[model samples]
Target: MGNVKKKKIALGLQLLIALFLGGAAGFFLPQFASFYQFLGQAFIRLISMLIIPLVLPLVVVAVAEVLGKNHFQKLLGKTFLYFFAVTTGITALFVFASYYLGFGQGVNIGQEGASLEGIATGVKIDEFFLNFIPSNLFKALTDGALLPILIFAIFLGYGVGQLEQEKKEAFLSGTKIWIAAIYKILDAVILLSPVGVFGFIAKDVATTGVDKLLGLGQFVLGMYLGYGVLALVIFPVIAILYKVNYVKLFKSIGDLVTLAFVSGGSSVVLPPLLKRLKKEGYDEAVTDFVVPLGYSFNLEGAAVYFALATVFLANAYGITFTPQALLFTVLLLSLIGKTAATIPSGAIVVLLAAAPQLGLPVEGVALILSVDFFANAGRTALNVVGQALAVAVLDSKKEKTEKVEKPAKAENVTGKELIANAG
Candidate 1:
């Protein structure tokens, strides 16, 4: 354990150094941005290649094991309830904050050529619902459609749980073997993250440039401010409530957090995050269940970005929202935030899909896109932290509940033994 911790600290320092070096390279040697971009993108692709294979069997085995336990419903309910409440609360707060603070005020939409070419604008209610159920599971896996894969995994896991005990155990054992193998591969991929982070940060800084970021300074600052409060203030408070050592927890996962921030992709950190949470003594079942599900549902960081970005765009378009309109926007964003994990550039895609409905100009999204990377870095880091914290808190609660139950079980056993002795 001591060795592992030392290694993590070493890796964390390496990532920070890489981030600095990358930023300098991007700023001073923009000529090599394309090369940096290639390195960064290749790293992401390597991680992405393993996501479906890792998440599918992992979720299946987790859900199956949880269902085989007595506390399945209670655990599942608590997890989703936590996710929904936290995400919705963050979304609402940021929506109101961005509006009142005039985050997008005086911003001009000069990036007219910024096209929403690939992203589909305007929500299709039927299509959105249909997406949750993939017509072809293989197609969904190929396309990396996470929602469908998750849905399929859950049902498959539940079905496996209903099988004869021996069969179920055999199936689970096989899947566990598969998941373990994937982790081995994933760990190898993660060791290259310093190189990846350097390239990713370099490419982003070089391509986005400081002037464009400065122009959208208010929006970027507001987004980071939201991320800061969530990570530094709100999450610490949650850690306290759950009796988790906030400082120690973050310290242990500092390397993964840095990677998430620099890479701007939370999925890349999932493997290490899970391993670290388990090492922290969070229940294996709960950590496995909550963290993956949290990726899909409990995106507190994306909630902040989406809510703030919506208001910022609205403000840029000089669109005013009444109480009813603001309420509606908050609700819509809270729902959209759930889908953020399923798509690439998810928050951006959902924002595009939602802009038309909110009466915000689609072109405004293009303007926000210019500085999205800066905001994305912060949000992705916050997302990773939030997921870990959720696991810690939920595990704490589970432990307390078990502690209360064990005494009752002891009493019952003692009473039975006394009666048997008396007889």
Candidate 2:
């Protein structure tokens, strides 16, 4: 126990130190851009390698296993709706607030290195159902088409759920081993994360000097402002309302939160998250179902960033939207982009997808990419917090229901015994 605590303390410090060193290197040693970029890309690739084997199987297995239990379907329904509602509502609010604050007004749109010729058509409302079915599963996964991959996982999970009891058990057991083995490998990879964080931040700083960040200060400030409100105010209120002790909850999950912020990959922090949830007295069944699903489906952080970036870019390009148009643009893009877990640079991919359709200068993507490291720290941390809060809320409701049921049964038994004694 003592050794574990020491390691946890050391890990957090190491990441923080690495971030500081990396930023310093970038500010002071711009000539080493190539080396730091290589290091950053390698680290990102290391995390990306875990996506297919980890994400698809984890989703399928968790869904399949939970489907066999009582009341889980209802739990699953509530979980899905909760994530969707919170993500959509909060994201819309940020976009509107950022717009009203004039985040991107009077910015000159850079044309150099900006090519908008091949922007894929945005998702149409009528075609939404058909868009989920990829022409080729392998290609979709390779292309990082997140919605297609999730759709595939959902189908495969349903198939597994239909298996005979013994067969289903055997299959899930095998999956458990596969996931565990991958997590063990991931544990090894995590040791190199400080180095990865250093490389990633250094490269960003090297490529875009501090002055460029200052030029975009309004947008960055707005982004962080949104994060500050969500983390400090909104999430805590939700926890308090649900009867979860907010202080204790954050204290318990501090390590996972640090991992989320530093690594900027919420998927990579699942092992620690699950362990923490279990230790904090969440049911194994609830954590098992919610955590992985949260990774794939519950990216509140990414949703907020998407909304802010979209509106900011629109403002920069001097594009004005009617209220209805703004509603259409923000909701469609933000919600669609939230369909799956993001890779390290996934926000750029999402920006590219939504920008062209909204008449936002595609080049505006570069602005956000420059400050992605800082943005990602806050965004991914929120993802972890959102997941934990979802579980706590549901578990609290479950406990209350049990309490009500237990006393009623006991009272009925006591009443029946008294009547029999009187007779």
Candidate 3:
């Protein structure tokens, strides 16, 4: 019997078809778009089912590992501070690029149907402060409130950090098992994303017409520009500083990122991604820690999108801010951007959060609301690739430096010397 080679179908291809169908349905039909909505909603909900559990245990493990009251603490503190600093810088760059590129001047002038009159665009500073603490855990979960969850996570992780060695090791072992189980569940669900993608695309096509899409093109262009600046300029330069080859890193993870672009949700393709990085000479500790941290804190794509979209909406409403308002907007964007998920609804959350603060008509967000789902597929993929590379460079440097002292002894002694001495 002749042997036939079986071909493995890549998830990226399926996600591409989903994107095409969903976009076409929303832009072409612009009438019966509920079908796409249902599909996209299904895909997002499937992911939501995975993130809470997947993230919590992983966070627990990462915190326990990083806060060992030794070198681990310094390593983590440095990595997080670097990521935070760069993210803030990237935020500034995006705001600057948006202004310099004149994205504000391109807003829709006569398209005034979705009114957000009397809507609260500005948030009180004190209430925003109070929202940081979780008054009740159950209430937070029911509301999908991220800040409270984050506070709880930080506290629990700190508690884990305080455990005795034997107990901590026991917890770490059990936590790993739980994390593995969650990942398996995540993988199974992600395999079903194509159906969700197709439905989302087709339904969006059925509702929003092509002409309306054209009006939003400028803002889209600006967003793409801002994202490129960070990925290409900011992140690569950081890699160079750390002596990591940026080109090699990109080439290594290109396929996984393409899947992210096609799938529109990086979270769906994360299992394969972590595995791929492990194959490419990176540590599992780094991948597990950095990937989740990036998801929670490092939102480069949404950082760009939030600024660009907010400006677009602001322009549409004829609202121009002074330098103070602009600075405040950037600060708020830092928080919203960090919370931005690798999901469709994330953009809406950011848009609504910023609208009231900037006096950008909240309803104007509806303009980009439909396609924002697909817009961020590329964004999420890019972000995952960028953050993964960042982690690789940081961890490689860390691992290399830790090994510096061991290598000198290798040069001075050999197995022959050891055997002679033993005899």
Candidate 4:
């Protein structure tokens, strides 16, 4: 345990250094941009390589664990509601703030590096929803489409839940072992993250240069300001209502937040997050259920960025969103924006995907792509925080329900009140 804690601290320091070193290399060493870019892509690919083996079985096991318990449907409903409500509310705030601030009004990105075909826009809403059905399960798994994989895992886990008790235990036991092996592999991959962070930032800096950053300053500031409102203002209100110790909660998960910011992907942070949830006294079952799905679904931070990007992009092109278009964008983001995690530069892909529907220029993607590493740091931190918040809130709800039930269970067992009533 002591060694593990020491390693975490060491890793955190390494990641911080990588962030600074990558930025310096990018800013001062533009000639070697390709080299840094290679390192960054290599790191992303290494982690991506682990996704199929790690994510698939982990989702199956988590869903199976949830299904085998009582009130499975109830738990799912409540948690999903909490995720949607918080995400929707915060997204509205982002849109309102960006619109009022007029972030992208005068900014214009050069077309030198902008390639509309290279962007992943023009995906229709019908097609987006249809793909969720997954015509080929193997293809979906190989392609690393998380929503389809999740769908497959849910069905398989439900099947496992219906098995005979002995067989169910055996299956679950085997699944746990499988997941542990994958985690061991991920442990090896995690050590390379600092190198990855350095490369990613350096490459972007070398290629994008200072001009893009200066031009997009307001959008970037507005993006961070939105996150600030969500983190400082909104999260605390929810925490207070849920009776959570907000300061303690943030401190406990600070390392995970740093990991997400540096890695720029929340999927990689799940193992440590689960460990923290357990250490912090949340139920193991709830931890298993909430954290995995929440990683894929509860991306409130990314949603905020996407919302701000939409308004920012519209303003950049001197376009305006009709009231109907604006409402549609918010609703779409609240529902499908989180699906961006299924692809590379997920937050950006989400923006591109919604570009057609929202009437924003597809080329605006290039503008955001240049600064994605910095933007992703903030968004990814929020993703980690959002998941942790879900666990805290839901776990608190569970405790309250249990507390309310304990007296009834005692009353039934003791029967002294029944005897007194009879007399």
> Evaluated with lDDT, which candidate comes out highest?
1
Off by over 4 Å in 4: 1-9, 106-113, 321-325, 342-344, 396-423
Q: Model 1, stretches more than 4 Å misplaced?
A: 1-9, 109-113, 342-344, 396-423
- Predicted structure 2: clash tally: 0
lDDT of each: 0.83, 0.74, 0.69, 0.76
Give model 3's clash tally.
17
**Cα deviation in Å at residue 417, candidate 3?**
26
Q: Looking at candidate 3, what is the lDDT of residue 27?
A: 69
Error of 1 at 76 (Å): 1.8
lDDT of 1 by residue, 283-312 (tens): 888888888888988888888889888998
Assess candidate 3 and give its lDDT.
Answer: 0.69
TM-score, structure 4 vs. true:
0.84
The local distance difference test score of model 1 is 0.83
Model 3 lDDT per residue over 1-423, tens place? 369877867776767776676666666676666766776678677777766666566666766776774555665676688778777777776676566556768565346535445433444556666776789988887776655665576577779889998999999899889878877777787687777777756765575566666766766666677677767887788888888878888877776676566556767655566657766656666666677667667767767777777776676576777777778888888866665656545656667767766777666776676456556865787777767776776675656454543544676777775454333
- As for candidate 2, its clashing pairs are none
